[model samples]
Target: MVFLKTLAYITLVLPLVVYLILNKRNNNKPSRVIFYYLVYSIVHEILVYYLTNFTDNISDSNAIPLLYAIFTIIEFFFLGYYIYDSLKNKLFKKVLLLCSIIFLITALINLFFIISSGVNNQLIDTIPVSTSAILLIIFSILYLFEEIQAPKIGFIYSNPKFWIIVGIMIYFTGTFFFFLLFSDLSGKDQYNYWIINLICIILKNIFFTISFFLPLENENSNEFDSSFGINHYNTIK
Candidate 1:
């Protein structure tokens, strides 16, 4: 668990370093959102680690759940926006946007319930995290299918969009079951299970960081971005 948390912090910070080195020269709407997401994640993870370890008062309170609930909403917004930008179909985008709205409203309701319940049970507002994972996973599969159908796009590994979505898949799949089973586990078990979550998040951050460093589209490359149809570089904004 200690190793995983260390890795998580390292991986989380690496992306920020890469972004600073690139200096937004490679920034696209998708990458920009990803960068900000990393920044937000670093802050949240630090706070969680501190509150969970240093403060005895938080162990039995709703503090952790409440903090995570709010972070889940913010995380979903960034990822949803990423998906919104990556997908090409107008109807899909509209549906995704609508789903995002509904999710926010539902999550806020959950937050309210959590705050008012005064329950000290291990139960959390896992609905938001689980729902976000399932929704993003489904949409990511849609995106991969979309890529498979495209005849002119280059190797999937070479596409920046591919890496971003893949990172989402990795993070969600890694922690999905953990969150699902969280309420059923003993507190000690939950602590150990968090190692799994952290490891996956580390990979997600690594892939996200790699997306920024990959060779950009040039006249000689076969890379075709679905969002732009062609190599429309800086116009993604």
Candidate 2:
């Protein structure tokens, strides 16, 4: 477990460092989504480390898992934004909008479930688990579309779209296992949960790294991106 945990840590951080370095060299900057996720991963790692050591007060550390959920929301925002941008066709655009709506509806449902269950303290944690699962599903369908059409809208998986699918598969699979390991009734050990987190962290980073390297068409093309418009280089310049 210790070895696995260490491996997970390395996988998680290494990709982010590589992305940052590569972006800097290219005179580009990392996205806010990447920045947020990276910071979240680091904090999550530290919390999990303490969690492994702080056995006596495990319940009190519920906030740790909740924090994971919070990051999940951020993750959704990031991926959803990317998906929206990568899509080009009018039909796919509608599908993309529909997916976003489904995710919004699912998120609200999950929120209600959390509140009704009276796990308000664990609200953040629950949100991420459910959201991550839903996001993965949604992304999978999108990848399928890309695969079927074989269109070159400038995604890492543009040529085959299989690479993005693989990344999504790894990411979704990682999140599912992590959720199961940490669910209130999983009966798993702390180390098991950490192992799951480690998997999630690594897989997710891999997804993001692949995404960064994947070619993007009209990266400056999104009108909705006014929220975070302007590349890092533009800002620095």
Candidate 3:
């Protein structure tokens, strides 16, 4: 478990460093948002780790659920926006926006009303996490579909957005069932299954790092605009 934990930390930290380096060269909106997400994730992890280790009082540990709930809300919004900005399909974009709004409303309700009544807000608020995962899965599929329909621009794997979508698909798909079942799991079961989440997270970060290393392409170029029917770079800006 210790080794697994260490590996997970390295995976998370390495991606952040990669993003920072890449951003220094040329920081696009999507990459900047993802970099901020990684920084938030690292800080949250450190806070949770130290708080759990240093505190004897369980009530003080309520910080974990609170922090996680807040993070989930912010993460869902930023990631959903990133996907929305990347896609060109009008109908799909509307669908993404509608779903995101619904998810945001649901998450707000869970955070304000349901969370306080539960021993752990994170467990009780699984709906938001699960919903976010499902929406992301849908967006990932849509992104891939768009990619397939678009004219081939060099190697598809070389596209940074392709790797980002791939990472989202892998992470969200792996954790979809986990988050759905999280509230139902016994303490021991939750502890045991956490390794699965950690493994998925590591894989996601590895993909993210790879994406950062890929050569930056001009998102507003004529090829991309003709294929996607939108100037994604301008849209993002």
RMSD of each: 6.3, 10.2, 6.2
Candidate 3 per-residue lDDT over residues 1-237, each given as its tens digit: 778889989999887788767766437887877778788888888987887788777453456677678888888877787788889999989999999888888888877764565455344358888888999999989988987887755667878878878888899899888888998998789889988888888899999889888766765552544524555545665
Question: Model 1, range 39-158, lDDT digits (tens) per residue?
Answer: 998888888889889998776688788888889999999988888887877877788888888888999998898888765565455678899888888778877877676655467788
Q: Write candidate 2's Cα lDDT for 1-237 as tens digits.
A: 778767777777765676666664323332444555566768776876686576675555455455555456556656566555556666766876776677667765664554455434442354456556666667667656664564233544442224444655666666575565454644445445666656765676666666555543343452334334535436766
- Against the reference, the lDDT scores of all candidates come to 0.81, 0.57, 0.80
State TM-scores per candidate: 0.86, 0.63, 0.87
Give the clashing residue pairs of candidate 1, or none.
none
Q: Is candidate 1 or candidate 2 better by lDDT?
A: 1
Superposition-based RMSD of candidate 1 using all C-alpha atoms, in angstroms: 6.3
Comparing candidate 1 with candidate 2, which one achieves the higher TM-score?
1
- Measured on C-alpha atoms, candidate 3 has an lDDT of 0.80
- lDDT for model 2 comes to 0.57
How many steric overlaps does candidate 3 have?
0
* Model 1 accuracy (lDDT, Cα): 0.81
Question: How are the candidates ranked when ordered by TM-score, highest leading?
Answer: 3, 1, 2
Q: Rank by lDDT, descending?
A: 1, 3, 2
